[model samples]
Target: MWQKHNPARELRSLLSRIETVSQPQVGLVADVLEHACPRLKSTLGPNALVRRLIEAEAWVDLGFWLIGWELPDWAVHRLSCDDSRWSCAICVRGLALNWVEDVAEFQHEDPALAILGAFVQAQVRKAQGHGPSNVTIFRRVERSGAVSMGPEVER
Candidate 1:
């Protein structure tokens, strides 16, 4: 029953709520969503709706990456172990792109982390009804010398 949780549906509903909002408002919503659900942030890169949300931010220049790689603009979702502090499992529709990036090095705190925490908490609460194993956060460190927040996941 835990697997029955439809994140896609939830995401769609959330996106629909902001459909008519202005670009800046959409970005704010995306920021909330990103903090509430980081998986959604990565997934939005490809999603037209999500792209609109990100574009509204005005500060982010995602077009460079979008055009340079010729990557299909589609949504990507992630379901990472709780220990993932910086990077997590990413699910992309067009490509299998999962890698760790130095998120902490950024000068500012990413709003997406807050969204991830909220989303994970909500999902865990829902899964409790079905007696699923507790959601565990796994902190993974990148070999590139970036420090992660929690204990490292043993390879």
Candidate 2:
């Protein structure tokens, strides 16, 4: 029997493929974005929302939309470091460090992508239902055989 389709895994797979900072014209990544945000579908068909946000580099807006969709009670915190990397985290409201994961905190060259990665990780954690316990971090291996401690890109 085929295993049931897992949205978290699917989202993570798509997240790994998006390596570039530019808006994608056509691909699975765009499809995943459309699938995640149903509210945008009626307003902007298919990947239009993702493309528009990426084109505008609207990281905070995208992050807010994604987090609000997944966990309405949660809030996102973001920071930009001196090394030109951006980190994003999702947490329960009123508790700055409670119930959030370092796994959700991802540093990326693009803040938008960083938020995207954090959203995916937060989804994965939510799906797994593990809260502040397991901490086995996995590094993403690129197609080029390079190992990146940061988030991986699919395309």
Candidate 3:
């Protein structure tokens, strides 16, 4: 039999290859991970791995992210959602540590997230600085492109 080769159907078939498993109590897992280390917080703050751990806890409370992706650092493996094969261990374990070693270092697949994060850092710098009275602060966060007065005078 010759298939019509529908792209949409083919895409759905590929997506189904991902796996999802259910667990009774996952909210406390992040806390356990935190206690496992003394400086987990200062180490991986605002990064992807920490974000996923938070989702694990929220999943128990609001019943989300538990069904689909694990968030931040989840991957498919061997066409199964089995806990033993879950990608968290392989993905998150050393990912954050690498970033800690070098702020510009990122092993994650996506590069756009890194660019967006750099933009946030730029905005933070503008927020707390001394600039000239005539300087204009461009607010890029909004689509309208806001402009506001900067500091009274340059330092």
The 0-to-1 C-alpha lDDT of every candidate, in the order given, reads 0.36, 0.59, 0.28
Report lDDT (Cα) of residue 24, candidate 2.
33
Cα misplacement distance, residue 45 of candidate 1 (Å): 18
What is candidate 2's local distance difference test score? 0.59
lDDT of 2 by residue, 1-155 (tens): 99997876765666676445444334533654654554455564435665676677565576667667555555676556548777776656654454435346666776766676666666666656743432334566666686677556555
Ranked candidates (TM-score, high to low): 2, 1, 3
**Which candidate tops TM-score?**
2
Task: Estimate candidate 1's alpha-carbon lDDT, on a 0 to 1 scale.
Answer: 0.36
lDDT of 1 by residue, 1-155 (tens): 36666654564444343333333245444443443344444553556744564666532233222311221222224323333332222222433332222010111123243233223333333333421222245666776787777767666
TM accuracy, model 3: 0.19
For each candidate in turn, the TM-score is 0.25, 0.57, 0.19
Model 1's TM-score against the true structure: 0.25
Clashing pairs in 3: none
Query: Higher TM-score: candidate 1 or 3?
Result: 1
Better of 2 and 3 by lDDT: 2
Candidate 3 ranges beyond 4 A from true positions: 1-27, 36-39, 47-155
Candidate 1: list runs displaced more than 4 Å.
1-4, 26-32, 35-155
Candidate 3 — what's its lDDT? 0.28
Cα lDDT tens digits for candidate 3, 44-139: 553475466455544322212221222223211112224343212112222344433212111112222222222222222223341112223443
